[model samples]
Each structure stands twice: as structure tokens, then as C-alpha cells.
Target: MRYLPLSPTEREDMLTRMGLAEIDDLFADAADKLLKAPLDLPRHKSELEVERALGALAAKNLAAGAVPFFLGAGAYKHHVPASVDHLIQRSEFLTSYTPYQPEISQGTLQVLFEFQTQVARLTGMDVANASMYDGSTAAAEAVLMAHRVTRRRNALLSGGLHPHYAETARTLSEMANDDIRILPPDPLAQEDLIAQLDDSLSCVVVQSPDVYGHLRDLRPLADACRAKGVLLVAVVTEILSLGLIESPGAQGADIVVAEGQSIGNGLNFGGPYLGLFATREKYVRQMPGRLCGQTLDSQGRRGFVLTLSTREQHIRREKATSNICTNSGLCALAFSIHLSLLGEKGLRELALVNHANAVALAEAIETIPGVKLLNQSFFNEFCVELPGPAAEFVERAAARNLLAGVPASRLSPRAGLDNLLLVASSELNTDADRATLVAALREEAAR
Candidate 1:
């Protein structure tokens, strides 16, 4: 179906009005290699044909749910309950937006309120926002929040932090002109990060069950930050790991941000993921995104409303804390539903299952020749130093129907880490899957 919003003449007229002759004019500076001579392929298909063709293509791909997928770095593969989807699709939530209309948006507001509460409790903080786009953005926002709270601009990102989250932080920092210090990505290189702490530092960002799945003792680091009057920003891409490991907040994090994808959200390709952010009550005022609060209506009945909206619609352009409008509503809703289903006991059990699966996998893989398990401590995901290129090894594993995780080379090709492979095993993996990966590694090494 041609869903083009503008007609040919409409587009031409608009372009003329804007003093542009053609769309190609906008691409004049584009790389010559990128300026392909349009598609020299098949003709456009009708809607029905398009659907059938896409379905055929999709059928050729392996479904992670159907296999024991051990591919996690940021996003995770977990069993999402059917009820979460059903509840999220209810007419009240499906049609709502903004939640500014208190009378009509009560249900949405209440759901968001509960979501915020669960996030705060889960992260062990005083309060949490309704949500952010995902973990990376939340990490970047946390850096900004720290800058605001400390009136300082320097941010020290731990070497163990997720590369994607670190990159996102750098992107925002470059724009904010915030001084950024990044520790080198070293899976086993433990350094005196605290010694770097000073008055110029706004916050120190670190991850637990870090990018390589190695867990770092955050106590000393947190203590140093606190003593230096620097805020500790903890980023957790694997929120489920929190149930099994120490809470980042309890470890002395002033601001805790995490990816809520592992729990209530499915790994739909890459996203739409919910970002969970939490912090002390004093820092709430500097928090980005919206916040839901409970109040009373005219009849003294319970109600919910969007109390703190830092985006442009709610505040002066210059005074707003974040221009990140439109909180991650649907993803947040999915997370809320999932978290509600997990309760306290359920989450802990699930976390235990994940850890057990990972441990089982590590033990099996350690026996494989030329495949060195790089992490001695981890929760679910860990890095392995392979005899060959990690990307090549992952491809070989994929050919054998195993979704071996991200490769270190994919993170940095020139970083001289070609032999490094990042692997993950989640609750979805079975004993057979662990055996399969180990056997495959042994066979590949023999070749």
C-alpha cells in the first residue's frame, strides 16, 4: 500500500516553496558510494504480496524463542507472560496519551504511578521516573542529572560499563560540552578509579555484572565518590541480574539507571525497551521525563496525575530539565505489567534460574580447547578469549543454530581484541544448549 503522506505535486510544491528543486539536492554531499542508482531489483509488490514475501523471509530466520539462545549483552531473551500483553492492550491504555486530562487519564496515570513505584522499589531508591526510552538514554540522562546536582561537568564512565551506554553518554556529553573521562575497556584490568575522583567530577558511572558479565565490587568505588562529594551513577543493562546481585543503590549509587527489557519487555529485535531510573528524593527535582503522583478528586476518590513533566510542554524552554518529550509509555506499561506479575519472590526465583543457567554454560565451555573464559566472576554474560576472531566464531556458531553473543571485535575492531568473544546464557537456555555450544567450540577448535 502506498502510504505516502504527500502527493507528487504536493511534494514538488512544498519543495518549491522551501526553495529546493529536488530531493536529490539534499544528498549532494552524501558519499558517492552511498548514492546508489536506485534499486536495480524487483518491482514493488502490493500490500498482500509484500506481507507474504516478508513472511517467507521471516520463516527463513531462526526464532530465539524456539532455540536456546545465549545472545545477550544489553537486551535479553526471557519468557514474557501472555497476561502482560493482554492487560497492556486494554481499551483504556491502548487509546490514552499525555495523561494530562486527569478525569479521562486516571487509569493510565495510575498504571504509570505503579510503574514508578515498582521501579523505585526494584532499584532501592526513594523515587523513579515514569520511564525513559531505554537504558542507554537513561544512563546519558543520569550523567546530565549529576551535572545538574553537583554543578560540575566532569563524568567518569567505568571501563566495565556497556559500550552502547558509554557511547550514548559520550554523544550527550559532547553536546552538553560536559568534560567526559572514559576508562579503557579492560575486562580484567582493575584500577584505582577512586583516585581520579575530585571536585571537578560530577558523577562516576559504572555497571554491575558489567558489559562482560563480570561483577565488580562497587563498595570501595562508591565510598570514594561519596567522600569526594561526587555522585555515583550506576547503570544496569541487565535489570534481572539485580535480583541475584547487590542492588546498585544499596552499593552507594546516588542515581540508578537500568534497562527494563529483561523483565516485562520482550527482545523485539532491539527495542522498544523501558528505561528504569531511580535516585534519592533530593535528586527527583533534577530527574528527566514525567512522574506520576497520587491525589484526591472532587469526591475524595483516589486519582493519579502527571506531576512533573520536564519536557517543553510543561515548562519554559530554557528552564526544562530535559527536552526528551513523550515518556516511553508502551514499554513502561509492558514493564509495569511484567513487574506486577513477578512480585518479589517471583523475580528472585527467575534471577536464580538465570544465574544457574549461566554457571552451567560456563562450566561446560571452560572444557573446550583454545576457548578461555575471560571472566572469573559474572552473573549471566561473560567474555571468552577464543583462538580465532570472535565475529568469525559467532558466525560459525550461528551456522550450527546457536546464537552466540556479541563479539569484542564488534565493539572495537582495532582495539587488538580480535580473540575476545562476549557470550551470554540466560534462563531460556537448557542443558542441551550448553552442551551444544561446548561441543561446537571443541569441534571448531579442532578445525
Candidate 2:
């Protein structure tokens, strides 16, 4: 019943063998606060008692589905079919890891292959990897891949790119001594990114239905990047937008990265979400994450194998395309399953419903006093400028049992955007829910 088999004498022996006096010596490099602070948790509890304690804590927070929820920035709330959950829980998928040997792991390998194909087709790219950690990490990886392909170290981040994604790319680029230029947030999608392009820039990242929900016209920026021999990295936080709009790849994006959570995954307080990464065939070797490729066995039987796995485990640390350890296998499976269920026609119809719902909500908000719409063209999400600080309005709404949208200041606290709120609508949203949000905002503004 002893988790730590070593007794006091055995532990002392090991420490002595390592020329250390105690186990704390092993954590000498850790921060003083980390080594000193004890967790504020009960020292002991029975299984049922622990469950009851945790349940009490959980009940203190409001569930998303219980309120008229309208939150969306990178994460969204879409109805996932019960069948998708049931299928992913199948023992073959729920517990599978990356198949080391493809011969015996055909089921998992094929699932990955299908996932890759689905992503590639959806993104209008020639190739796609299994998946990335999430949309932000994928954006960071795409920037690195551009650097590798172009032999340049400078990246340009659109003002509309999600702050988290921009921060992720900036941190990684800074570590490599690469230059990353980020424009100020442009809620109207009017930034002249083409004029900002230069020969030194390795890639240009633009997000459509950007953080503010203003759909960006990436064609001109893509042309500019191509003219300057710079790669164009297009980011999509709401992957469902692809169903309604022209694929970014079709508009000249060299690399496309997206958060596939909108398709099948739920916002489990942010993650675990699927990161969809795809690119043109010419840059496949430079792409990060594992790639699943279809092949034939000796018997001419169809098979799936890892075509490329440029990670620290498979290649020299310095030569690996990405230091990323693994992919979001289970999340990817869920995404694939959801998209499969919604064939091309079903996806388009779903997208149309999302757009219509958002438009109706925007119209309702616009009619209210002291509120202004910021997007002229958007898919399912948009921004609204309020009379007072968004944080204050959100708190007031929550008190009335309505979960309002994210405040722009929450993402960029110092950007002087406290009056801005980012809101989204999906198929899950109903007319009544939209009405509740508008009435709450109107009352908050009047106060």
C-alpha cells in the first residue's frame, strides 16, 4: 500500500550515493516559493468525502449551458452530437497513442490519416499533419516553419490576430532571437498590412474573422507576401468559418492553421482543443507535428504510416522542424468525427445558421442605446463598443445569471480597449438567448 517503496534508510542511502543530504537538495534549482509553499488541501480524506468536497467547489461556479452564454474569442460553444462523444470513447480511440508501429496500429493510424485529409481538404491545402497542441501553438509553429522555409527570421503579426496567438509566436520567436512585429489591434479590419511588408519579413500572419470578428481580406496581403518572397500564414480561431467563406489557401496562404474546437470539441474551460495545421506540398518537410500519409502494404493492401515526424524524438534536436513532443490525437479524432458527420452540405447549412444568428443578434444590439457594432462583415462573431467599460457590464450581466462575452481588455489589459466587447453566436444560440443579452446590455448602459 506504500506508494513510495523506499524507507527512511533506503532514501538516505540514495541521497548519500548522489552526494546529497536530503531530497530537497534535488530541488535546489527550483524556485524558493515553489519549494517552500505547501498546497492548501486537506491532508487526508476518503474517496466519497473527497468527491463531496470537490463537488461543493465545482457547484460554486456557473455552468456555461445553464446561462444565456455568449462568450467566444478563440473558444466557441457549438452543439456536438451525442454520437461523436460515444464514438470517441470507444476503447480503440479513447486510449490510443501515436502508433509507433503502423503495421499493428492501423486503426489509430488510419484515424490520423483521415483527420489529416479532412483538415487538408477543409483548409484547401495539399498536406496536413496529424494535429498540433492548440490553435495558439500551431500559430507559433507556423511562424517557425516560415522562418525555416524562407531562411528569414522576421515575422509580421496582424493586429487582429488573437492576442494569445501573437504572444505565443512572440515568445517563441524571441527565444530564437527572431524579430516579430505586431500591429495594434484593428477592429475594423482596415489595416494596410500590404504596405507594412518588407523583404526581411519571413511570414505574415492574418486571422480572418479576427479576434474582433471582422473578416479580413487576405488576398492583397497574400499577394504582397508572395511578391516579397515571404510566406503567408493564415490563422483561423473558428474553423467553422471555412464552411462559409473561401478557403485561405485558395486566396494564396502558404500555411493555414486553425483551432478545430468549433467542429466537435466543447470548451472545457478553454481546452483540450484540436489545432488544425496544413500547408502546400512544397513546404511539407518544414511543417511541424507528425504527418499521416496513406500507403500500400506488400500485399497491395491500403495502409497508413507516419510520413514525417520531425520532432526531437525522430530527429536531431537542432534539426527537428519543431520541438513539439506530440499531437492532440484524441481531440483530432473528435474533430474528424464531427466533420465527417456533417458532410459538405451539412457544414454549409450549419455555417449559414451561425451567420444568420449572429446577424440577428448584431441588429438587436445596434438598436439598443449606447452600443455600436464594429464589424461590417463577419461570420458568426463580432465586436461591439459600449458606453461604459466592458468588464463592468460583464459583471452586472453575470449577476443576472447571463454569461456575457469576453471584454477586449481582458485579452489586452493595457490596450485601452475596456469599452470593447467581443461576442459570438453559434448554432447553440437561440433567439431568446440573443434577446436576453441585448436586454441586459441595454439595462447596464442605462445604469
Candidate 3:
């Protein structure tokens, strides 16, 4: 009765008032498979019994830290400093909501401003927003922004772009009656993406250290996009890679978007991750999400405020540049805090360690009988072709207490890459972890 506040008669009356025969009728628009599906959960259970049942189900998952983790495609397994977790859990940050009142929300506003500055500096762009929902949505918003800026209806997507991001952009583009031309997956960075550019293209999306872990040369692509009057939207799933690689903006990208999960955030079984979005100063007016700006209050005191007025809430719906009402404020705070702790030099050093570990892992696996390395230029992650089905190898490795890499087939089933496995190495991965991965792969190959 505590959970179900309404009586059966009251529920019936509400349904009648809404002109619905039953509660199920409210889901008329949902597909039959979803609307008619049953959860198969028990109707009632004691608190202790419920906890035990949930714990049993949770135990079935492979904990990232409990095993030798090598899994990475989009989400990575980087070590977060203990201080980050402790600081983020503080009530001031964890309980804060959107900073609607500039005067009273100075702490939240300043944090977001610092986050935007850090993102802009990291991306080598002129400006950056507060943050976005995540990398995938930021990518989709980038496409929409391009459409508005270029006044074009077509986009060109690189083959190596993360499938999830590509799909998100395509879904939004399709809804707007635009064309999304996605190239096939490129295990090798050999695609001539420049040739695909044309005047009708609104934007060209490309990912560096792509899903398969191959770094791309964005300069040539950026040149071609410029020649065709197309916006070059560069996507980076690993923000730390920027410390080692050239910033996408420096390579002529008009806009740069990245996932900020690698620095301060953990895998957390996927999200809530932060999205970093930045662009050239000339195009800042068209950028999606919110932008935090540094200003002086009436008393000549320093203050922070939302700079651009383009989100749906602040403007007419039809005239709004983006509908992103809120941002990942807490995650952005975590990101800024971590980056502040690890300044420019520290970030570079951390990146170097990650690259060294990955190189060591690659070398260790290359000696194995049936595994072959596929990336010539990668930051901390690379793709390997296993002698057997990668999915089977992954399962076998898991049996050996090694949380191995993600199989390419699992992410892109139609790509015909059953033997390709994506492996990543972070600073957290130790010599023992690499050895464990090597031994597991060797054992699987021998079998």
C-alpha cells in the first residue's frame, strides 16, 4: 500500500478519465514485443530475499578490477585516482543541480567554466561548451550543428568511426530528412575519405584512434572538407590520446568532440560519462549545449555565467541552436578536478605510460602463435586478429580469470570480423596483467 498509493477503484477512475480501457492501453504505440513482454519477476519478496536474489544476479557479471582487464572500444578501463572519487562524492558537487541562478550558483558555474576551458585547450579549439550527455550524443549534436551551419542535407562518415556514434548521428540525420553516407568499417586506415567529399556534404565525421584503434591523419581530410566547404567534425573516444597525438583542431577540424571518461571517470559498467564539445570561435554561436563564460560582477568581483544564449530553454524553440537543456555537471566537475590535479605535463606523462603498456602488450601477444597486430599507429588501444573466433577466445580467456578484449563481431556483427578482437592497455595494466593476457591467449590458441 505504501508503494501503490491509489486503490483499484481510483486507478479505474483515472484510466476512465483518460479515455483508456486499461493501463496497458497507454502503451499502444510501443511495439508488441515490448508492450506485451513480461519481466518474470516475483510479485513480492522479503527485503533480505530480494537483496540475496539481486546479489546472485550481480555476481554473474565479470568485475573489471577483479580480473586482468583488456576490454576497450569506446569505454576504457583507466585508473581513477582515489581523490577523484572522494571529492566527487562530496555533497556540494553530488547534490548540485543545474545552475539556474548565476549569483547563488557561483561554485557550480565556475566549475563548468573551468571544464569548458580545459576541453578547449585539450581539443585545441577556440571555445567549448559546459558539457554534453556523452560522446555519442555530442556527435549527433555536432551533425545537427553542421547541417544548420552549412545549410546542407548530406553527411559523410568515416568507416572507422565508432558504430554507436555513427548510428546516433544517422538516427538524428534521418529524422531531419538528411542523408548519412557511412563508409564500411576500416580495420586498416587505408580509406581515401577525401575522395568522398563533395559540395553537397554538410559535414564529415571521422574518429582518431578509431574503434579498431588505428590513428587517422585528419589534415588531409580536413583539407578536402575545406575545399568542399564541409565541416570537419572530429570524434575522439579517448580524451587522453590528445596528450600524445596532435589536437584534431590543429589538423583543420572545424569542430572537435570527445568522450571525457578516460581521465577522471571509470567504466562504471558504461556511463554516466561526460562529453567534451568544442569548436572554432567563429562557429561558437552554432555550437550545441551550454557554454560557461568568465565575467566580472557589478562589484568588479570575478564571476561565471552561461555565455551563449542558444539552448531551447533560453530562446524560442524554433530558433534554438540545440535542445540540450542540461549538462553532465557532476561528471564535468570530476573531469576538471582530475585535470587540474594532472596539469599539462602530468597528462602527457600519463599518456606516455599508457602507450608504453599497450606497446608491451602488443609485443607480448605478437609472439603468440595465432594472434596478429593490426594497428601501426595507436595510442593505448589496438586491434588483433586471433587465430580462432575472437568471441570464443574472449570466453576462454574469461574462464582463465582474464577479462579479455571485446570481439569486433560483438560490436559490428555485419562487419564479418569474427576473428578481430579490440585490446586496450592503460596505466592500470601491469606486467602481471599483460602476462596473464598473453598466457590466456596462448592457451586458447593451443586448444
Candidate 4:
């Protein structure tokens, strides 16, 4: 039998004390659209039956590694060192909770401190937090932080920003009743973001090697925002690009937020990914999540501790910089381990391989009839315009045992980008995989 924590009378008494009429009343502030009927799912099932049903459903998924996969919009397919998995699974790393009491959590705290240093150095920023839930949420938190810093409520998001990231920021900003302006989708990275800036704007959000896979020059936008007293927030969906290209911090981004999944983590069928956030030292207090720092103990021994935790749980709700309760600890540990394995030189070399592979893929696709490469510059991903709907071409490619790429419409359904597709390549993609992808595209074009 299922255990019920509270009896009817106790629940009614608690509700009455809280001035709520019923359990449903507790969710009264939620929007009517969000308050949907309960899902039509089985209330009970035997363990064996449930396992069989789930296995059957899981069998339908096309594993990324099983085919000639090129799919990447945000999440990417990378070669994670077997050692990374082995190291993170150790009892101390896997079983540890938040480093609440630093005395007993030295190992976890030191790892986080190192992770912060790596992210700050990688992004060319003054400091970095331990981690955030993921890239999108880090971005939303960045906007909120900007609002707090500039004492302004308006934010301008470039068209090239990932649609999901934009939506995430929008949802958070709506609650605070802030103004967020997102430009039209620009696959070619041709939007004039400077023209949209004004004194009322708090920040401008732009993605490098943006959603369409075009590498953007944030310098001009950065200069513009600086002139307007606006914070320039740089978003990196593909963190691998940082090794080969100029770091966002060097390019004058007042704030840099990135999805660190490409490094030490796999796509994992979408999540348990890592978020990297960093900024100048002056804005450390305004940063979300936690900051791990080094200190000297009673005997003068070096120790790590939670230097700053501005979340609601650590302080008064009104005084907290963010409501985010915890960091993505295990995922962050995996990322730290992977980066440790790949020293600075190693990361750059790996990045070069990814770029070389993507360049080869782009060259192959250019040879296909009626297909056009959309990016003049990119790191390891780019957009291509096909003769027909991109979604239909993707389906056809899948039937031919090749996972081509992400169709633009899948991410921005209402943007009229049906003919565009986002393709990515990494060290794991071999000549055979590229050839297979090319052959499939050639077949589609011939039709």
C-alpha cells in the first residue's frame, strides 16, 4: 500500500492555517492554461509488465551512435573518454550531496573550486559560479542578474539566439514583468542588433555560432552595448568552439553563459547537462548559483569553501539573487574531470579536429545539387538550405540509415525556415559517416 504522509484532518487543518480552502487552491496563482487535467496513465502496474512496456517504447528511439548521425542544435555528439565515466562513478564523487558543511565536504568543494577556475579561464572572465541547471536556465538567470545590475527591466535578444533559450528567458522575465524583445530569426547572422539598442535596455543577448550554426562577431555588438550602458550577454551553445575561437570574455561580453555539455558530458538523450556562467569580478555578488573559493584553515592548511551562495535557500528570499536551489554537482564533476584530462593544448587540438570535420562535411554538401551552405564562418556546425522542406529531407535521410541534421522548423516552427537545416560534426564522425551523409543528401537532391 502507498503511504500517505498526512491524514485528511491534518491536511485540512494545515490548509486552514495557511488560509487555503483546498489543495487545488494552493495552485490558484498558476495560469488556467497550465492547470491541466491529470494525465491519462495507468495507476498501477506489475514490475515485470512495466519494464516490458518501457522497453518496448525505448526500442523506438534511434540511437545517435547507431546511425551516421549529424544532429546538433544545442546538444552534440562527442567522444567522451572512458576514463571520465570511470572517475565520476567513484563513491565519493557520485554519492556526495551539496557541499553544505565545508569541513566534511572538502573534496566536493575543491572540485567545484577547480571547476569554477576552469570555466573562468576558458571563458576569459574574472570569475565563474560552480554551475547552473543547464545552459538555458543559466541564460535566464543571466538576464535576471543583468536587471539587478543595471536597475533596468528591458532586454534585447538577437534573432540568432536559440529559440528555446529565448523562450526560457521570456518565461522567467514574464514573472518579473520585464520587457524582452527577440528579433526575427536570422540564419545568416545579418541582423543589425546595434540599431535596436537604447537607454532603456538592460542587456543584449546573442549566441556565438548561433542556433543556425553561424559564427557571430560579438565585438561590434559589445561596443554598441557598452556605449549605451547596456550589458552584453554572450551565449555559447557549443562550448567546444571556445577552444578554437576568441573567448566571449575577450570579445567584451559583460556576462558569458554557455552549455558545457560538449566537453565532459554526452547528450544523454537531452539532459543532465552542465551550465557554465562567468563574468567580471565586480559582478560576482550578482551572479546566480554558488561560488567556491579557497581559504586557509586553523592550521594554515589550504581549504575550499562556499564563498558565495545567493540562492533563496541560503538567504532570505527577497535578498537572494536567484531562486535556483542547487548546482548540477555530478554533471559539473564530470565536466571538470574531462577538462582536466584535456589540458589547454589538448582542448585546442580537439577543437581543431571538430572544425576540420565540419569543414569537410560542408565541402561534401556543397557538391550536392540544389543545396547551399549558409555560413561564411563557423567552428564545427553550419546551416544548409535545401531545395525542399528540411523536415522531409531529414525523414528521408533517416529512412536511408543516416541521421542528417536538425531541421530549422523543428526549433522555430513559426519562423518559415522549413528549407534550412543545422548540421554538426565532431571527432567521432568518420569519413565513412560523412560519405554516408553525403550519399543520402545526393539521393534526396536527385529526386
Best by TM-score: 2
Instruction: Please give the distance, in angstroms, between residue 143's alpha carbon in candidate 1 and its true position after superposition.
Output: 0.6
Query: 1-447 in candidate 2: lDDT tens per residue?
Result: 145588999989999999998788888877475547568875777778879999999999999899899999999989999999999999978776678888988988898988988999999999998999999999999999999999999999999999999999999999989999999988778788989899999999999979999888778888888999999999999999999999998989999999999888999888898899999998887888888788999999999988766544466577787777788988988898999999899899999999999999999998998899988998999999999999989998898899889999999989999999999988888788998999888887787
Tens-place lDDT digits, model 3, residues 137-216: 99989988899899897888998999889989889889888899989988987899888888999999999989999999
Candidate 3 residues lying further than 4 Å off, grouped into runs, are 1-57
Model 4 has a clash total of 0
Q: Model 2, stretches more than 4 Å misplaced?
A: 1-47, 310-312
Model 4 is weakest, by summed lDDT over 10 consecutive residues, at 307-316
The local lDDT score (0 to 100) that residue 239 gets in candidate 2 is 94
Q: Give candidate 3's TM-score.
A: 0.88
C-alpha TM-score for every candidate: 0.88, 0.90, 0.88, 0.88
Clashes of 2: 0
User: Model 3: clashing residue pairs?
Assistant: none
Clashing pairs in model 1, backbone N/Cα/C closer than 3 A? none
lDDT of 4 at 428: 85
Candidate 4: clashing pairs of residues: none
> Of models 2 and 3, which has the larger TM-score?
2
Q: Give the candidate order by descending lDDT.
A: 4, 2, 3, 1
Q: Model 1: how far is 350 from its true place, Å?
A: 0.6
